[model samples]
Target chain A: MEQILANGVYLGAQYAMIALGLTLIFALMNVLNFAHGQMYVLGGFVTYTFYGQLGFPFVAGLVMSCVTLFILGALIERFLFAPVIRRSSRDESTMLLAAGLAFFFDAVILLLFGEKQRGVPKIVNGVFNWDFRLIMPYDRILICVLAILSIVSFILFMQYSKTGRALRALAQDRTAAQLMGVNVDRYSMIGFALGAMLAGLVGGLLVTITGVNLGMGGPTSIKAFMMVMIGGAGVISGAIAGGIILGFLEAIGLAVLSQYGDITYLMIFVSLMIFLAIRPQGLMGKPWG
Target chain B: MKRRVVLKSAVAAVALSAFAAGGAWAENPVLKIGFVGVTSGPAAAWGISNQRSMETRAAWINETGGYTIGDTTYDIEIVSFDDQKDPKRAIAGMEKMAQEGIHYVVGPNVDDGAAAVRPVAEANGIMYFPYAFPKELYTAPASNAVLGMVANYQSGPAIYKYLMENKGVKTVAFIAANESDPLSQRDGGVAAAKELGLEVVSDNVTYQVDTTDFTPVLTPVLRTRPDLLVLSGVSPANAPQLIRSARELGYQGLISTETAQDAQVLQEGAGDLANGFISVGGASTPELASDAMREFVKRYTDMFGEYNDESNTKVYALEYILETLKANPAAIDDVNAFQATMDGFEAPNPYMVGDAKLRYVGSTSFGQKRQVAVPLVVNVYQDGAFETLFVAEVD
Candidate 1:
């Protein structure tokens, strides 16, 4: 039970970090940001180059990932999203653009990084075993703590900072925020960049453990969607709750269903479907089109 | 009168140039071979290795005045398609090869891709050597796909017997990626292990191919305390993570797989934790590698900026195709003729030093000469390289 809990907590922390960025972008831009996962992959490669290849300190590599993704996000929002959203009439048009961007990022990543599985040296070593009941690696524990810290930092920033206040108002009501002199274009760009930075931060952190590849982008986005759906799309608290819930369910399912074999994931998916059928709005989401 | 003289002089010039070259032909013809497989996604290494090996050998042969069969010396050209690991795309790739009028091809590296392209290969009279291991692909009523490497069943029993006799292994466990290819391999490994009189303590453990953290998936298998853990049909990308997870879980038993792995990947992904890991490797070891094999590796490295160990096995498919065509030039355009030639086909293996021979086997396993008879070279991962564990033959 202890081992399962530890696994759940660790998995939840990382999953929540991944969902946070996707949810943030959706809330700010009202665009699904399908390339969010590719942005995450770009972050991982940046860190892989800086830390794994260039012998930089791990912290520096992580910071570099954030800075790089942040700039990229701002540029993408200004050049790609803003122009398309302006000219397009239908919401699905943005979805198409987002999907196209996903393919573009996938191609760019494959060209730049190649298809080899890459990893970094463990930042810390040794196992954290408590009588074989609650076993965890120190690297995992450090990453979990760091992810939680980053999440808290993000919440504080959104709650207190002037830019964060402006972004929240924009997300709440774009026209009202614009009338209030929030600089809609600039604040929207900042919010998108912030969201992308979170993705980069998680990607940079998890690259040490899971490592990243071009193929991971699609699945990561899908998993992030599951979390958002479970918690409620475009809701930050919903994303975190959804992440933790899915994480615990996977941990428990794997632990209990070992005797039954590969059907654990199938059973989990079925249960989720049943839950969604009963409550389509998810745990905390309001009805939306 | 002037036009007639010009034409006469042009004909004489052609004849004189051909006669001067001491040949009856103007220039050599080109034989195009096709490669269809994943060379872009996560599993890119597998097909990339296959494509690179073919390209390297083709370059070498072309550089050395082309390959002569019967009355003609022909240039080797590789036509490749990146299926991106999708079966539907693999079918399209096969169709493209047929459209190009290629008779012999290599690849579609995974099980589904191989299986998917079979009908196209048969209908189009194209012979494809695939790196997949489903027995039905080589059995009766199916003839186009030739097994490119040693199957898990063959390597599994061999490893199990060696361990049971030498390392005292009694109980074993199996884990796979929950995909069709790996699951099929797990079943084969399970059967092979059982036939060898070893107990399969656990065999149902599986994880998604995209799984990053394997602790949850491996914990129950570890609890069973099997002496041997077989990762069935594992890809190069996922092998090290599984090994690292098992070791970090304090598994003191032996870990093995039945697929070629990249040493650099293992080193990067698992570091020292990958030491003592066992796997089926490319058919040649350092001791077994001929000078030609060494040169091929050097050229492959030079051409691609790096070399993949899997290419050691991949290098043989195109050679087999060309040599078989040379044996009976009729097979160049007729695949049925190629199938007829297989039962009695024999050639000297160029990759090895000694009296190693290249031919088709699988009469015992599949009741046909539908498998490549490459020497099975078992490898154990050490610091940053795969040291030879043992070498065996498939009969």
Candidate 2:
């Protein structure tokens, strides 16, 4: 039980970080950024090249990932999404654009990174075996701590900062924010860039543990989407809650359902469907607070 | 005027002959071979090795005066498709090959892709060598899908028997990814372990292919404490993670897999933790690799920036296809003729140190000559490379 809890906490921390970024983008733009996972993968590759290949400090690599993704997000919003959202009548237009970007990123990742699975040297070594009850690697524990710290920082920023306040105002009511003299166009781009930065931060932190691959992009996006849906489509707290819940479910299901084998994932999916059927709006879909 | 007319007539005759010669040169035939497999995505290494091997060999053949089959010399051209590991896409890849008029091809590397292309291959008179091990694929009803490399069923028993006799392996556990190819391999490995009188401690554990954390997945399997742990049909991407997880969980037993693996992937993913892992690999062991094999590796490394050791086994599929075609040229456009030729086809294995013969043999498992008889070279991972352990063969 202790081991399962530890495992769940670790998984939940990282998963929540991933969900936070996706939900943030959706909240700001109503775009449901399908390319969020690819952004995460690109962030991982950036770190891999910087730290693993070029022998830079790991922290430097992570900061580079965040900066690179932030700029990319800003440009994409400024040049692509912003114009499309203005010209189009339906939100599905944004969805189509997001989907197209996902494919475009997939091709770019393949062309640039090739198809080989890549991994970095362990940041920390040795296992923390607690009386044979809880066996977690030191590296995993460090990553979990880092992930939690990032999430906490994000929450604090969203609560206190002026930019965060403006972004929140925009997310709350775009027309009202525009009427109140907020630069709607600029904050929308910043919001998207900030969301992308968070994805990169988490991607950098987790790359040491799970490694990165081109194929991981689509599945990562799918998993992130599930977390958003569980939390409530455009709710930040809901996304975090959804991520943690899904993480624990996986840890527990894998631990308990060892006897039943392949049906573990099947059971998890079935439960998700049941929950969705019961509460169509999800756990935190009602409001931002 | 008479002198001018004669000179013009002679010049016209020379120009017409030059044109005729140029037309003859342009008419030289190109024999097209096809490869349909996953060349991108996580499992890309598997199919990439297969495609690169075919391309490398084709280029070698074409550069050195081309290949001759039944007195007609033809340049070999490899046409490839990236099925992206999808069954429907693999079917489409095969149809594309048929449309291109390629009669012989290599790959569709995994079981699902291999099985999916069988009907298309048969209908189009295309003979394909797939690196999959479904007995039904090689049985009487299916004849076009030749087993490209040693199957898990064949390699599993060979590996288990060797471990039992040499390392005193008395008990075993099996874990597999929850997919068709891996599940099939796990079942086969379990049966082989049981047949060898080894106690099967645990065999039903499976994890999703996309699983990032394998600790919880390995915890229960490690608790069983078997002497040997077989990772069934593991891909290059997952192998190192599984090894690292098992080791971290304090599994002290021998770890082995029937699938060929990339040494670089293992080294990068698990580092020193992967040291002692055993797998079936290409015949690239220093003791077994001949000068021809060394040159091929050099060429491969030159062509691609790095080399995947799995190509050791993959290089033979194209060789077998070409060799069989050479033995009976009538088989080039008639896959039925190719089937008829398989029973008696034999040639000297060019890449091995011994007087080994290249042939088709699967009578023991499929009651037909439906598998390439490459020397099954088992490899043990140490440091950053795979060293040859023992070599075996399947009938």
Tell me the deviation in Å of residue B220 in model 2.
Answer: 1.0
For candidate 1 chain B, the 10 contiguous residues with the lowest summed lDDT are B20-29
Which ranges in model 2 have alpha carbons more than 4 Å from their true place?
A287-289, B1-28, B63-65
lDDT of 1 at B135: 85
Please give each candidate's TM-score: 0.93, 0.93
- Best candidate, lDDT: 1
Which portions of model 1 miss their true places by more than 4 Å? Answer: B1-29, B62-66
lDDT of 1 by residue, B1-395 (tens): 99999999999999988798756323678899999998875677888889999999999998899999889899888999999889999999999999999989898899999999999999999999999888888898998988888988888889989999989999999999888889999999899999999999999988878788888889999999999999988888788888888888889899999999989888878889999999999988899999999999999988877788999999999989998999999998999999999999999999999988889999888998999999999999999899999999885
After the best TM-score superposition of candidate 2, give how far the Cα of residue B63 lies from its true spot, in angstroms: 4.1
Model 2 lDDT per residue over A74-187, tens place: 999999999999999798999999999988988898767766777788899999999879999999999999998988888899999999899889988999999998899999
